[model samples]
Target: MARPGRVAVAVPAALLLAACSADPAQPSRQPSDQPAVARSTTPEPSASPSVEPEPQPTPVAPDDLDVSTATGTVRHLAGVVGPREATGPAFARAADWVARAFERQGYDVSRQRVDVPAGESWGVPVSAGRSANVVATPLGFDPTEPHLVVGAHLDTVPQAPGAEDNASGVGVVLAVSAAVSGRRTRLPVVFVAFGAEEPRGPSDDDHHYGSRRYVALLAPAERAAVRGMVSLDRVGVGATVPVGSASDGDPVQRSLLAAARRAGVPAVPDPGQRSSDHWSFVRNGLPGARLGSTPYAGYHSAGDVPAVVERAQLERVGRLLLEWLAPR
Candidate 1:
């Protein structure tokens, strides 16, 4: 989640999907000064990108999402993992834990390595190091087929354990994955636990390294196959979920809002929210949005512990996403 107000970069025309605006004043994530390099994930010879007819399977029951499961994950990340700065060993442990969680649900998990150069984040000097994004896909996932991306950052600022900033987001994604496991859907979905979402420097490029690299490395076909993406960030504190995009009237946002209505969840539209991993996808021409609330009192501070997260909020978000993923 990079902060807004920075000038946008030009991506290759072949990769562009849509254009977005960058406005300032959002207390979002930031990036390091230097460009991060992306590395390949574990090889999967069987699953290759190819255009194919969409699958038309019988609708399966949606998973019964549990709030306690999401809460447990939040506690483990904020309490057990502690402050997981992207360059620290704690981040590595957290990444491993996330990958294992996906594997337990029988998904094909991969760790995409991201190399970040030394830079300053919020005036603090950061050392150059390696981090990885934990990516999970259903078995036999085909890139040519349309799919939805659900992602959350796994790293936290050094000053706090980041229960609300992101542990809450990760917990929701994991809960969704667990509930949907073994269930067939109208569209395939991919889950990513991003690294380095916190700003490493003053520049916008300094943040969202995992998401930026993930989108950058995608083949054109793969990019086109993404129907929409949702970034679940800081969802544990607000009374109502805030579903926002780069600007107003985004189809993805509309779909999410409609889903919320059908699911009987309280949600509101928040336009121009360019402050999370979803912005990475939106700026690159894909339909993307963020599901988060207003900043909490402990934002980027040590006060952002598990106590700030609310169970009801987590349940609301989990139910919203579950309904959104259901076959239309």
Candidate 2:
């Protein structure tokens, strides 16, 4: 991993500061409190079942990816919390960092333990321990209304610096949470950093364990109040936005299209692929959409480090998602 140190983000300092106001309040956390997981609308049939393999995006030069990488967002995050392996100490520490980010945004933060077998990662034998998820909700919202969850997984493969695999996703979620504080939304927004998203067993159930448990544990009332789930996975690289959970012409995809056009983000519709944490929500009848990168060459290797993340791409995806959840 690159030696930990502060680096400059590409945008003008003033612009970055203005986009997310700083908060003086210290973070307040309650780790045991799990946020409500409500039932979402079933994947209602679409007249146009728009599900197809997304075309591969043009390969970006490594130099191009780094030209505008944001230091505070991507670099700082990857450095401070590099390669947080599932259920490992670093993973727990990563959760702390995310909780602090939420508090800095003036939102209350909490943690919920995710069930995983003792001493293992997805059936792969390891000494990794229990994992937990982070949750934060903006204040002064109507509790009666179903809420929208904006989530990203927080775990990485053993000993690997998962910059694009995930740290980028965590940073984008923080950026979005920071940018939209105190704003009203069509549905209340909840920010989560799910643990154990990496495969824990050979079966599909072993993967996306964090979100899967989150949905399974939700009280029926909470489930009933769920409006939707927006999962952000591996979003720090690639220029194109891959919509993983929503099919062509689905309500969630439609909303994303409108938001992307509004935000001027160029995106390619994906086949609502369930390879990421969003699938956890989809199986439980909640509408979901994953915005992520094309593919990273260093995906699960030690080569996946901070320098490879596209700072500008990270900012664009975060901004686009913020627009999608903003009151509309």
Candidate 3:
């Protein structure tokens, strides 16, 4: 999960219902008012306009799933943008880096604003600020069609570089996205790097602000079209991946476990593990699960560096996701 000491706070039924029922605000489109141009008395024959063909998507080969790409991203996020607290300048830089990475992979990228209210991070008072969630989708993704969401938290605790806490998760997500870019799958996928996943205070509402805002902004059709969501978090340290969810018998979690088995990767189930971004979707009446493992020496400390992340572990997670989404 995110941190070691944070506990899961149960969301009130009323709040959950409200969030599920609310509709995203749409922008008003006003018609332009201008004087009409007079038609020519004798219209001349118009020439045929030339049309250029659209560019085709670049196909991703099997060799594109390189371990170095995922390792480099983890090193950069942990060593370069170290201590990326939510809504901070470092976190903003990380978000920008993620957006650029998605653009390089030929995906359409967008940023969703996440407003953080005044709160405390681990008892330290924090001022209200704005953060963002970076979202990436295929060039012509349709919202009304069935789709899947692959997400990972981007922010880290102030005292830790978070190589294992979450830089690893973001790295796996990017690597998986790159490997599946131009491939055909059963459902289209949307990748998101969530901000503000670290606990900002004692309450649960202080965490997962980015993901909660994302789900809240989804239109009814968009929400309904989501088949499932998988949050890759802290998959760098463990030998066996753990697939967890808020409750038992979750179809998404079960599917992930089955996928791992089919891919010949070791994975276990961790029920009632609600300490990541997937909880945001599950609480809002959506199917979601977290794929990660715990029991690391450096949970949220300065010792969580790039050296602690294992490239093999990253590849295992990436391969599992690929098998589940776009199986060869």
Off by over 4 Å in 2: 1-73, 118-124, 140-144
TM-scores for candidates 1 onward, in order = 0.81, 0.74, 0.80
* Residue-by-residue lDDT tens digits, candidate 3, 1-328: 5654443434466678887787755333445785445556797979989899977544443345677778999999999989888878999999999999999988999999999887777556677888899999998899778999999999987788999989999998999888888876667899999988888777678789999999999999999998999999999987899999999989999999998888888999999988899999999999999999677898889899999999889988888888788634
Number of the top-ranking candidate, with lDDT as the measure: 1
Query: Candidate 1: where are CA atoms >4 Å away?
Result: 1-63
Error of 1 at 211 (Å): 0.2
Q: Rate the local accuracy (lDDT) of all candidates.
A: 0.88, 0.73, 0.87
When sorted by TM-score, best at the front, the candidate numbers are 1, 3, 2
TM-score of 3: 0.80
> Candidate 2, which ten residues in sequence have the lowest lDDT sum?
58-67
Regarding lDDT, does 2 or 3 come out ahead?
3
Name the best candidate (by TM-score): 1
TM-score between model 1 and native: 0.81
Q: Which candidate would rank higher by lDDT, 1 or 3?
A: 1
Candidate 1, 1-328: lDDT as tens digits: 7545342543443245432333344333447785555545777679768899977554533347877878999999998889898989999999989899999989999988889878876556789999889999999999888999999999987778999989999999999988777776658999999999889877779889999999998999999999999999999987899999899999899999999999889899999888899999999999999998677799888888999999999999999998888887
